[model samples]
Target: MSFLRSLSPLRAWRDLRRFLALRKPHEIGFMVISFAVTGTILFALYKDAAIPPTYKRDVLYVESWPLSRTDREIIDQQKADLIAEKKRAAELRARQLKRQAEFKRLDDRLERLGI
Candidate 1:
């Protein structure tokens, strides 16, 4: 039964031919152009898919002094300076808050004395 059903290539081809024959000329032209464009795009992509490997020099030489203890010390000093600046900023904020509180107290005292 399945073999008989599978042997329908003639019917399929006939249906396909009938469908194509019924299609308008403009519709057929557009379909052909779309297929050609898709095929060309796929071919272009397949052709350019490979990347060539690159070569590099195996030997290297130093013309100047590499990183030393002094470089590390300089980096450490910069980090310490940043930390100190942050601490100074925090202290200044605390001082400003204290000054604001003192000013509020003075204003209250002056208002109480009516002066």
Candidate 2:
């Protein structure tokens, strides 16, 4: 009980009061800057919460229509182009892999021949 009495709330309050009273100009400036930054962050968060996302405004829950014949033909043409491009890419990748394997085989043969 005596030890607890020695470290009382009143003493801590007084110490905190004295520390605040003894703040220098630079310390006061830093404290003001920190408060301003925290206020700006809180204001930004408030603004963000008030506004809805752009996607919700533009696209979400919007009605869609089925394609017309011309639109469907255009989409089919685009799909065929994409499939051709993918096939070309796969062929290029296979050729690259084969070239790499051939280089490795030649390197191994050169090493075996001590050259």
Give each model a TM-score: 0.40, 0.36
Tell me the tens digit of each residue's lDDT in model 2 across 19-59: 98899989989998999999999999999899865332334
What does candidate 1's lDDT look like per residue over 1-115, in tens digits?
9888877889999999999999999999999999999999999998888656433454756456456659777789789979988997898789889989999999999999998
User: Alpha carbon lDDT of residue 40, candidate 2?
Assistant: 100
Question: What is residue 89's positional error in candidate 1, in angstroms?
Answer: 48
RMSD of each: 22.8, 17.2
Best by TM-score: 1
As for model 1, its CA RMSD to the true structure in angstroms is: 22.8
